[model samples]
Target: MTSQDLLLRILNKLFLGLAAAGIFFGVMGRSRAAERPNIVLILADDLGYGDVSCYGATKVQTPNIDKVAESGLRFLDAHSSSATCTPSRYALLTGEYPWRKKGTGILPGDANLIIKPGSTTLPEMLRKGGYKTGAVGKWHLGLGDGEIDWNTEIKPGPLEIGFDYSFIMPATADRVPCVFVENHRVVDLDAKDPIQVSFKEKVGSDPTGQEHPELLKMRPSHGHDMTIVNGISRIGYMSGGKSARWVDEELAQTLTKQAVGFIEKNKDGPFFLYFATHDIHVPRVPNARFAGKSGMGPRGDVILQFDWTVGEIVKTLRQLKLEDNTILIVTSDNGPVVDDGYQDQAREKLNGHRPAGPLRGGKYSAFEGGTRVPFILSWPGHVKSGVSDALICQIDFLASFAQLTGCRLNQADGPDSLNILPAFVGDSKMGRDYVVEHAFVLALRKGNQKFIEPGKGPKFSKPTATETGIDPDGLFYDLTDDIGETNNLSIQVSEKAKQYQAELEKLRKEGRSRP
Candidate 1:
């Protein structure tokens, strides 16, 4: 053979080898992507550790939520990043403590979007990892840039923050703009009657609860007395968008349907559904089917309704044959509150129910009840069926999920999120080295020792009638012995308290907790 012929043959062989290797790696990449499971994170509003039946509530049975615990691992020591809704949600999505940011506090309905655009969020990270992301129901994390024109397309919202599809209540049910926002537009909105919302002053001639108490079906116990919509007063003044306004009674069903639709639409493979429910919140209105069923009035009835919503989602997953490939996580934004704002007989009707279970405080508290919520993780054949005592926090979801999808996170991504995937799937009992709980005051938890930094504030909240968990002198407790946080061990364990105080200051000043 000629020398040119031999050279041509060698070049041809090299090209073929390179092409074969590329095809092999491409197939492997596809296989790994296929193995990634669908994550459905159902976050309940104001649900406490003792609210669900599996978590030891006897007043109201949460059979659907209990089923999740029975199917997989139930975490005994899981907490949200904060005691309030907006802050906890911010932490869960951003993977950074909400305290690290300003203006992350409970936002007004008309407030601007708090989650900055172009930031690394849990859904965004999953989307980059080849997953379809959707958010349904309660979105208290504000919307738009300052004043929002409800008639026009809302920008810098859930869509801009990572969700491919979004069906959200602009704020809370108790807040103004009492309507459902599908994607960027208000659902069922009429262009002629644009929505105008104002937290500052009364916007329209709409009769408020304070002006016309007789018009209300559910009276406000406190400050939820602004605009009257569907015979219920909300926190802010909203006029117009009459057709777009949501009915308190049908909220659970409507949100559940949207969640089910999202799951069905994305049944192809990998998807992330952040289903934040509005049930059991203020204006406690349960559908006719669940009304008077709990025998504990509005609060109890709504809890039952919330359970039904969970059942519907689980049923959809099963019917679609997606249960086996789905990782279902059921948790709450914070602790519970019997009387948030509505005089719905939540406090009066509780015969023997303990909303916070054995925990000390609830809602806007620094105690265990505020941040420690019921956390259940179920993935059929993937996560083993058992109970775990691992100290995991919802803020860790971003990093843990990144690990699951084999996605490499940058140094700036999930700054406070530690990859506790092993503990999440029941593979390990140890989770985080420490977790900081946020409320009126910041509390640090290392192992079983909890330290609350000294602060100046009302010891208790008069509006919600909840303990603020604040003390002029710092408080410390060994949770292994005092789960309710009744005893303060600051004096006894002075050295330990000092160490935790120093660590908390260090973590706060350093900006990121993840090492």
Candidate 2:
């Protein structure tokens, strides 16, 4: 037979196999068997590429996180849009780059809702497809208008932004208010004392870490010396709501319990749970149960606790028989930061363990460590278990999920999100050709080549103690060859660097990365 006839026969057989598989799974129909899968997006706070055992952290054992990787599709090239929690969370939810919108930075606890009303969100898209959506833990996206009364019902918040039920931390654990917000009210708050929160000025007569360092269990390394709550000082000032204040150690347990409860209550049908954990962030106070578990101090202990949280959710899913039908994603908001603020012995007890692994820079950096995080997507009996180098981002969840559930969205809805559902489910090996990383500076990554534009800023942020990746001269590195970014190939490959710079400019000017 001729080569043309052989190619035609091979294509015919491939089509037949796909048709058979589609018929068996009802992939071409919207039948009950084809019901939209339940989604559980577990966002870990400050989890780095090397934080999980599966990702090569020898000091920390993350057996549960490894389970997800063992049974799911793990992506080596997955990244968050930015290197900070607030900005990355905004980009993930809004499907727009945080830099495009003003006020999308590290927010004070009292800051207003940065996500505007009527904005289409990931939860909103899922809700449109008849899925009940719930958000629990670490909602640092701000709440209410600019001047919100903590005593009153905080409206125009998560509920208005597509979450059917929300129990969130309002902000970071290190930030104040330092209480859980269930639905629209503060959980266990008393009306007699009322809750008062302030970032600029002192709220009440509560003793601060600055005034009484002896009272603090964990001393602030930098600016986390405001109001004392549960023996730990936070970034902002809070006076009343004693009953509502969350114990620093109990945070992981509380958030995990909330997530399990949300899953149990919404187990009747399709549901979406955004379980954002504050574990491994600053004030690394792990529960007594997890103390000394890692022998690497609070930082490592909290990582173990975070793993436990993942185990609990997975256990719940298995008990309810939701594992097969549930789509669980385990990923981080950004890279790691050892000594963010508190004196937690994260740096001292590191014992030569690299949190960012082979990647240079962490947290607030334009390098791979800042945004490239461990991403795992698991749906038992549906998605094949394997490792993929496909370049995927948390921002693509909005558009990819919309297509997965048959929910239609216009380009206006998710200007930066792309429908890479095939890659997500392990059906395709290829994903986006390039993606942008935002930090103090902007950088573009196309395949193995990375180009960082020139920007003016202090090369190092003294507070976070991170390299800001800012320089007057543009930077370029072939990440495939030099993962540490030690070599400057911009001068050697001037033409390629210029091309990437132009691509970055065009992407910025167009205001959207997806076509």
Candidate 3:
């Protein structure tokens, strides 16, 4: 044969080999993508570490949440990044400490979107890894660019951030403009009755709790006394959009339906569902079926309702035959609060039930109970069914999931999120070397030792009747010995306290803590 003919033959063989290899790798890539589990993160609002039956609450029966623990790994030392809803959620999605950003504190119903439009978010990252993302239920993270017209499209919200679809309450249950926002516009809003919300001043001629106390079915205990919607007074005044307003008692069922719909729609492949439940929050109004079930009044009844919500989700997954290929994470945005705003009988009818369990303080406090929440991960055959004391936080989900989905994250993305996938799936006992807990003040936890930075504030919040866990001088505790944080050991362990204080300050100032 001629030299040219031999060269042509060799080139043809090389091209064929390269094409075959490409096809093989392409098939392998598709297989790996299909293998990625559907992630459903159920974040309960104000659900304390001890609220569920599995977490030691005998008063409240949480069979569904317990089922998750029984089926997979339960995390004993799991924490949210912040003690409050808005900030905690921000951290969970952005992978940056909420304290790192300004305006991340609890916001009014009409507050502008805190998360930037083009930022790299958990849902966005998952989308990059070939997953459909949806967010349902309470979105206290705020919506719109600045001022939002309830009758029009609300831009720069969950959709702009990462989620492909979003059905969320613009804020909390007790907040005004109490309507579900699906994607951009207010759900079921009537154009004729345009919605107007004002946090600064009373908007419209709606009967407010302060003005029409006689008309209210539920009175406010403190500051949640603004617009009256569905006979319940709320914070911030909202006018019109009567058709779009949500019923307090039907909230659980409404949100659950949406969540289930999302799951069913995405059952064919990998999906990320951030189901943030508004249950057990303020203005506890459970459905008639769950109303008197707990015997602990509205608060207890709502807890049962939350469990039902969980059960519904699990049942839906099972029905779709997606349970085995799904990663279900049940946790809370923060700890519990007995009386946040509305005069629900949560505090009056305690009935010997401890919301914070053995942990000290709760909700907005700088204590263990404030950030420490019941975290359960269920992935059928993937994650071993056992108790894991791995020191994990919601903030790490972004990095861990990124690692799991084979998505490469830039240095700027998930700045504070450490890839703790090994510990997440129960492969390792140890997770983060340290985790920063943010509340009214910041606290650093390295090993079992926790150090609360010095801050000036009321020791206790009168409205909520919760210990603020604040001090002018820094406080330290070895949680392994004192999980309640009753005994402050800063004076006894001055050097360790100093070291932790320095570390905490460094972490705060350095801007990122992923390293």
Candidate 4:
């Protein structure tokens, strides 16, 4: 054989060998992508930063939550998008600042669906990325249009947004039409006793807390004096659907059942579950099993109940052998509120327990307690056990999860969500340079300095009895020194305040925070 012929044969053989290796690696890469972990986002309602034992609450024991922190990365400076419920949930799912959208505040039970259909939602993005998405628990994000027929199918809710399956409380536990919504229909509705709900006027002859104090099991402290369901006064008026009315004490177990069912059904592969717990919220009635378990009160007992729910979910994951490949996130919608509207003895039975820890304000406030919450990210074997002080917002989940699942989002989707996947997975220390905190007014946190924009509002909210964190002349604070936000530094650090304000305004006008 000629030398030239032998060299050509050698080259041809080498080329074939490389082609075979390329095919092998390509298949392996696809297999790894297919094994992308399941995501479980456990959102607690009205839970404070210090509510969890892991986050430093001495009054209540949260062993299940603490286990999650120990198993993965616990974030110190994480925040929900808003200080209130509806807006915070809106930002969490849509990845847009709630302030950008008007009418995103705490809504009435009969309010219209705030999230428009066909929008790019977190669940929708995940569903499109080959994952089954389910949302169970409190869905205060209003369902249907302004006028919804409770007897009929409720449209444009979790299902319309993106969830493949959903079992949720239509509104809050302290609201009217106190019923669970499975898919688009009220659970166990009766034709003879049809459900009728109204926020504007009294629709039914149901005894209200104001008219009939004799009928109430737990009296309202303020505005939740409209309708009585399960012997508890709610915020709106509702008639009929007695069978569908949810028992307050059974709420925890009911929601837990649905959550566990979702996980079980989808245990074969990647699934995204948004388990929004109503525990520790208004009308704090824990199940009989957990009742009076906490020495604190119903509030503390519900925290224990919430912890049980977490434990149950983790247990299910472990039982199914899905723990290692699951990304579990435990956080609150906002901070804690002892007495929101109901007289649940959360304040009187405080017993020196600090719900917000060392933070100043709670719930409807611009203080650290309002938005700052315990954020834990656990991905067994993938994310290491540690703590991250990096600034993160629940709104970042959409973009971060998108990046994790190899999904590309344009500017229209998750405009404010940054892909802090590195920080999320304990691979990086640096997170966002600054994060926006929303209450009645807007505040910007750049490094340790936080600047609150001047706004005209009540200095203190009478309902929650919380310092609204609002000032007519604006406010500023160095969080590194004053985490409680005791003294205002707007005058002392005038230039720094102005600089943050200017940057905040610029971000507002830009229409998008992430590139």
* Collision count for each candidate, in order: 0, 0, 0, 0
Which pairs of residues have clashing backbones in candidate 2?
none
lDDT to native, each model: 0.90, 0.89, 0.90, 0.88
Candidates' TM-scores? 0.93, 0.95, 0.93, 0.93
Q: For this target, which candidate reaches the highest lDDT against the unseen true structure?
A: 1
lDDT, candidate 4, 354-460, per-residue tens: 99988988899998889999899999987789999998889988987776787668778888988776677776777888899999989998878898899898988
Candidate 3: stretches off by over 4 Å: 1-34
TM-score: which is higher, 2 or 4? 2
Q: Write the per-residue lDDT of candidate 3 for residues 1-515, one digit (tens) a residue.
A: 99999999998887656534443223333233347899999999999998999989998799999999999999999999999999999999999999999999999888899999889999999998899999999998888876687787889899999999999998999888899999988999888999998989987899888888999988998987788999998989889999989998899999999999999999997899999999889889989999989989899999999999999999999999999999999999999999888887888788999999999999998999999999999999767899999899999999888877878789999899998877888867889999999998999988898999899989898867799889999899988878899889989999988888888888878999886
Which has the higher lDDT value, candidate number 3 or candidate number 4? 3
User: Candidate 4, clashing residue pairs?
Assistant: none
* Model 2: lDDT to the true structure: 0.89
Query: What TM value does model 1 have?
Result: 0.93
Error of 3 at 464 (Å): 1.8
Which digits, one per residue and each the tens of the lDDT, describe model 1 over residues 1-515? 99999999998787556434443223333233348999999999998898899988998899999898899899999999999999999999999999999999999898889999989999999998899999999998989996799899898899998999999998899999999999999999988888898999999789999999999999998999989999999999999999999988899999999999999999996999999999778889999999999989999999999999989999999999999999999999999988889889888898899989999999999999999999999999867899999999999999888877877688998889998877888767889988899999999998998999988999989887799899988899989989999899899988888888898899989999787
